[model samples]
Target: MHTTHHCKARQSQRGISLKMVNYVLTHGALENDKIVLGKKEAMQRLADLEREKRLLMKIADKGGVVVVADGEALITTYNCSHRN
Candidate 1:
């Protein structure tokens, strides 16, 4: 899949803000359903809650978020302080 240069530029010029990066990483699965963000905004959009949960847990497992994926799961990515 192609990467969005918009994100790349944002991270390069200004360090990825914790809030915005968190949103991108979570795939719109915010805690308490309070963090307002468009569902369509996620890079790793899952079909439903179960899939989303699994995805988020997988992300939380690998040290916050790092762009990595395989055939078994969709390409999910995240950045705590930007993964160089």
Candidate 2:
């Protein structure tokens, strides 16, 4: 049981790390091997992260795929039907 719990915790940490990497790669500016964001932009990004997280949680509760857009300051969600 202890080993199973540890494995689950490790998987959760990996997921979080992946999310951070994705966010950085999409939005962060890489300068001299360092990821950087401007003061105002950083604050705005934090707000956007919270908003996106809440949205993702709601969607996950309904068993929906998590969809995210580019890291621009604008937050937009599209509702379109897929045609098979």
Candidate 3:
């Protein structure tokens, strides 16, 4: 997550947030040492998330609440009827 001064300047100029850079790092395909998230890869990742959301929705419809946590800290909670 470390950014060089030049990188920070370019990011400001390009309006690319650190969050977006992290997303590309996490999900992007590796080319040599660089990570690249092209349009196709981005679309595929979004589609995969959508499929997971649908599955979670089905469970929620069955009166299940999906709780996502990190260790003991709750990250998110959701159901078909409500979200927290």
Candidate 4:
């Protein structure tokens, strides 16, 4: 007998870049396809959760929103229990 694994896919669309999806998920913004967003919404969605606010971007271009950490762009990926 062979065992098959049941994998749960995250994003509704496969075209959504893994980096982009992971970005939103990690920041406590998006919840399973919903995002409580923030500013720069004109081209992207973001949220200042501490400030209790959200901004929605009207554009649909999948531009890479650079997130800087410790004076550098955080470009990375690793093997975790989850991924996009």
Residue-wise C-alpha lDDT for candidate 3, range 1-84, written one tens digit per residue: 678999999999999999999999898889998999999988998999999999988896767877899999999986545545
Alpha carbon lDDT of each predicted model: 0.64, 0.67, 0.88, 0.41
Off by over 4 Å in 4: 1-14, 28-33, 36-84
Give the per-residue lDDT digits (tens) of candidate 1, residues 35-54: 44565744234456669788
The per-prediction tally of clashing pairs is 1, 0, 0, 7
Q: How accurate locally is residue 4 in candidate 4, as Cα lDDT from 0 to 100?
A: 26
Every model's TM-score? 0.25, 0.36, 0.72, 0.23
**lDDT for each residue of candidate 2 in 3-73, tens digit (9 for 90 to 100):** 36664678687774555545666788889977766678779988999999999887666656434567765
Residue pairs whose backbone atoms clash in candidate 1: 65-78
Better of 1 and 2 by TM-score: 2
lDDT for each residue of candidate 4 in 46-83, tens digit (9 for 90 to 100) = 23442333222311132323334555656653323332
Candidate with maximal TM-score: 3
lDDT of 2 at 72: 60
Off by over 4 Å in 3: 65-84
**Whole-model lDDT, candidate 1?**
0.64
Give lDDT: candidate 4, residue 77.
35
